[model samples]
Target: MRQTLLATSLLGLSAIMPAYAADYVIDTEKAHAFIDFRIQHLGYSWMSGRFNDFSGTFSYDAEKPEASKVDVDIDVTSVDTNFAERDKHLRERFLETDKFPKASFKSTSFKQQDDGSLMVTGDFTLHGVTHELSFPVQKVGEGADPWGGYRAGFVGETEFTISDYGINVDMLGPSSQVVYLTLSIEGIKQ
Candidate 1:
C-alpha cells in the first residue's frame, strides 16, 4: 500500500538525517563552573588562582561528537589569588587588566579520540593576543535533572607560557614561566 511505502520512506529519511545538537549555557549564575590556574612560585611551590566571572555556551551532538563547539569569555579583572598585594601586582603589571579586560576561547574543531575523550582545538585570546591552542577534554557526565532540566559537564586542562601571550615572565622567575589552566564547565540545556 502507499501508506506503508510512505511510512518506510519517512523512517529512512529520519535515519539518514543528522540528529539535532543541544545548545547549553554555562551555569555561572549557579556557580557550577570555574576557571582555575596554577603556576610555579619561584621553583619551590605553586601559586593557585581563579577567575570569578565568566560565561560561555556550547553545542554538543551525541551522535556526532566531532561537530561540538564551545565559546567562553572571561573577565580578566576578576582574577583572585587569595593575596591582595600579589593580586594587585598581577592585575597591574602582569595581566594589565585595565588594558585588556577580557580573554576568550572559541573552538575551531572537536575531534573524538579512541579513548572517548575529545581533542579540542581553538583560538585563545589573552592579553590582546590570539593563539591556537589544543587540549584534551573529558565529559564528566550528562543527564536529566530532578527539576525537569538537562545538564552536561566537562573538564579540560592546558598550559601555556606567560611570555607567549606577551606577559612579562621575568618577575615570575624561570620556574614560573608556564601557567597551567583548568576549565571545569557545567552547562544547562537551553
Candidate 2:
C-alpha cells in the first residue's frame, strides 16, 4: 500500500512538471532558410535583395510557446542585389560592411495569438545600432523529413527605416526610407 501511494505521488508530480523545449538549428547548410529584403527605388519600383549568409537557432515549446526564443547572425557583406555596382555601393556607402560586417537578432519575447500565429519581439542589431522590433510569424509546418530528421518552418516579416540603424536614408530618396525584411526559416531539430 505504501509503494502504491509513493508511485501515485510521483506520477502526480510528473504531471505538474514543465515540458522541455526542443532546440533546433536553422538549416542554412541546405539553403532552407533565407533573409530577404525589399526597398523602394526612387519611388519608381521595388528593389529586392537577399543576404547570402546567415545562421540561427531557436528553441520551441509547444506547451509553452511564450517561452520560445530565437537568435540569428547575418553576414552584412553578403548582401546581394544582383547588380555588382549597386551592391558595392551598398556595402561601401550605406551598410559600410568594412566597419560593421555583421548583424544579429535576439528574440526577447514570443506571444501566441488566437489565430495560432506568434508575435515575436526582439532586439535587432544592424550597422552597429540596436533597436527593438516586433513582427508576426506564421508557422508554415512541422514534420519529419525523408532523411529521418524532424523540421519546423516559419515565415516572418517586418519593416524599419534605414535611419533607425544609423544608415543614411537621404541618398536613397524619401520613398526608400523604409526597408522591408522577410525571414523564411526552416530549422532541423537538434
Candidate 3:
C-alpha cells in the first residue's frame, strides 16, 4: 500500500510540474543571419546597408508557439552600405557606434495567424532607445544542415521611422524618415 501511495504521489507531482520549452542557440559562426536596412536618400533613391555581425537565440515549436522566444544582438560598427566613406559617416554621425555600439531585440509575445503565419511582437532597442516593434514572420525552410546540425530558417520584414529612434532626419538632408528592414535568420538546434 505504501509503494502504491508513493507511486501515485510521484506521478501527481510530475503532472503538476510546469512544462519547459526546448531552445536553440544562434549559430553565430555559421548562422548566415542578415540584418539589412534601407532608407530614402536625399529625396531621391534609397541607400541600403547591412550589418555583418550579429547573434541570436530562440525557442520555437510549431505546435507550441506560445512558448517561443527570441533574443538578438547586432553590432553597430559592422554596418556596411558598400561605400566606405558613407559607411563611416553613417557609423559616426547617424549611428554613433562609439556612443551606442550595439542594438538588440527581444520577443515579448507571439500571435499565430489563421494563415499559418506568426506575428512576433517585441522590444527593439536602437540608438539607446527601446521601442515596441512587431514583424510578420514566415517559415522559410527547415531541415538538417550539411554539418550535421538541425536547422530552421525564418524571414521577417518591417518598416519604421528612423526619427522615432532619435536619429536626425535633417542632418542627413531631406532624407525619408521611414526605413525598411528585413531579417533572414537560420538558427541551429543546440
Candidate 4:
C-alpha cells in the first residue's frame, strides 16, 4: 500500500512539473522592433523616418492566445532621420524626449480571427499619455533557426493623428493631421 501511494505522488509531481515550467521568454538579442512613421511634409508628399532603438519582451504559449503577453518600451530620443539637425529638433522641441523619454505598450488581450490573423487590444503610452489602441496582427509564419532558436514573424500596422497625441506638425504649415505608423517585429524564442 505504501508503494502504491509513493507511485501516485510521483505521477502527480511529474504532471505539475511540465505546467510549472512552460514559460517561454523572448530572446532580445535576436529580436527586432522597428517602427516607420511618416508625417505629411507638404500638400504633395510625406516625410518619413524610423526609430533606431527600441526593446521589448514577450511571453507566449504556442497553443493559446490567453497565455500570450507582451511588454514593449521604446526610447523616444532614439529618433533618427539620418540627418542630425532634423533629429535634434524633433527630439528636443517636438517630441520633447527629455520630458517624455519613452513610449510603451502592454497587451490586454488577443483574439484569433477566422483568417488566421489576430486582433490585439492593448494600451499604448506615448509622450506621457495613455490610450487604448487595438490593431490587427498577422502571423507571417514561424521557422527553426540553424542555431536552434525558433523565429516567429509578425506584422502590425496602425495610424494615429499627431494632434491626437498633442503633436503639432502644423508648424510645418501645410501638413496633414494624420501620421502613419508601421511596426515590423521579429521575435526569437529561446
Candidate 5:
C-alpha cells in the first residue's frame, strides 16, 4: 500500500510538471531563417536577393516570457539571387562576405506587446557592424509532431537600410538600399 501511494504521488507531480523544462534548447535542424532584400539595378528595375544558409536557437515558454531568449547566425556568403553572375558580384563587392562571413543577433529581452505578440529587441551584427534592431514576432503555434518531437514556430520581420551595415553603394550606384529580413524559426524541443 505504501509503494502504491508513493507511485501515485510521483505520477501526480509528473503530471503537473512540463514534459520539457523551459530551459530546453532549440534544435536548429527543425528551424528556418530567410533574408529578403531588393536593390535598384541602375535605376531600371529592382533586383531581389535572399540568403539561404542561416541558423538560430531560441528558448521560449509562453508562461515565462522573461526566461525566453534567442540567438541567430546568418552566413553572409550564402547570398543567392538565382543568377550566378549577380550572386558573385554581390558576395565579392557588395557584402564583402570574405571579410565578414557571418552576421549575428543576440536578444536583450523579450516583451509581450498589446496585440499579444512578442517583440525581441537586440543587437544585430552585419558586415562587422552592430546595430540595434527590434522585430515583431508571433508565436505561430506549438504541437506534437507525428515523429514524436514537439515543435514551436515563430514569425518575425524587420527592415533596415543597407548603408547602415557599412556596405559600399557606389557599385550599386545608390547611397542606400532598403533591406528587408523575414524570420520563420521553428524549433524542436528535445
Candidate 6:
C-alpha cells in the first residue's frame, strides 16, 4: 500500500506528496519465492520444474513505481524436475552446474505500462552468458503479516531459448527450444 505524506499549508490546508521509497528484501524462506518453468517435452507434453533455492532484494515505491529496482540470484544446481535422472542430466549436461553454478538478474530500468503492469528491463545471466531482457511483472498485493511484518508479492513472466544462451539442445531433438518461465516473488519490508 501507498502512504501519502502531508505537506501543510499556511491556509490550514494540506497537500499530498509521494511517499519515500523503501527497500524490501526477499524473505526466501518465508515467501516461498519460486522460479518455475515449462517447456515442450517429446512434442506431446509439457515438462515443468522449479528452482528450489534463490534469493533477491528489491525496492518498491507505490507512488513512484518507476523508481523500483530488483536483483535476483538463483542456485542453478537446485533445479528440481521431480525425476532424479533427469535432474542429474540437467545439472551435468545441460546446465553444466560444475562450471556455472549460479544464474542472476539485475534490473536496469522500470517502466509502468498503461495497463498498470510493470516492464522491467534487466541483464539476465545464465550458463555464464549475460543478455539484456525485458519482461512483464504485476504486483500481486501487499499487506501486514501476522508476524508484524509487511510483505509484497509480484509475478513475472518471461521466456528464452537454450540456443540463445549457447546451450546445446541435441537431446530434445525436435522439441520446442523455448523455455517459458513464471516467477513468484515476495519481499518483506526491512
Instruction: Give the winner by TM-score.
Output: 1
Least accurate stretch of 10 residues (summed lDDT) in model 2?
A: 164-173
Q: Which runs of model 5 end up more than 4 angstroms from their true locations?
A: 1-33, 39-46, 171-176
lDDT of 4 by residue, 83-183 (tens): 89999999987888989989988899888888877778799888788888888887676778787877676777887767667766576754566767777
Provide the lDDT at 88 for model 6.
99
Better of 2 and 6 by lDDT: 2
Which consecutive 10 residues in model 3 have the weakest lDDT in total? 168-177
Models sorted by TM-score, best on top: 1, 2, 6, 3, 4, 5
Q: Which wins on lDDT, candidate 2 or candidate 5? A: 2
* lDDT digits (tens) for residues 1-190 of candidate 6: 1223232342234234446677888878864588999889878899999999999999998989899999999999999999999999999998999999999999999999999999999999999999898999999999899899898999999999888887976676557688898989988999
* lDDT assessment of candidate 2: 0.95
Q: Rate the local accuracy (lDDT) of all candidates.
A: 0.95, 0.95, 0.86, 0.74, 0.79, 0.88
- Cα TM-score per model: 0.95, 0.95, 0.86, 0.81, 0.80, 0.89
Deviation of model 5 at 47, angstroms: 3.0
Question: In candidate 6, which residue pairs clash?
Answer: none
TM-score, model 4 to reference: 0.81
- Runs in model 2 deviating more than 4 A are 1-10
lDDT of 2 by residue, 1-190 (tens): 9999999999999999888889999999989999999999989999999999999999887779898899999999999999999999999999999999999999999999999999999999999999999999998989899999999999999999999899974876899999999999999999
Please give the lDDT score at residue 140 for candidate 4: 70
Off by over 4 Å in 4: 1-31, 173-175
Worst 10 residues of 4 by lDDT: 19-28
Candidate 5 local lDDT, 1-190, one digit each (tens) = 9999999999999989864334334454543445566666766777877777777778888876656788888898988899999899888887898899999989998888999889899999999999999988998888887888788888888888878889756755652376767777777775
lDDT for position 20 in model 1: 79
Q: Which tens-of-lDDT digit does each residue in 61-167 have in candidate 1?
A: 88888999999999999999999999898999999999999999999999999999999999999999999999999999999998899999999999998889999
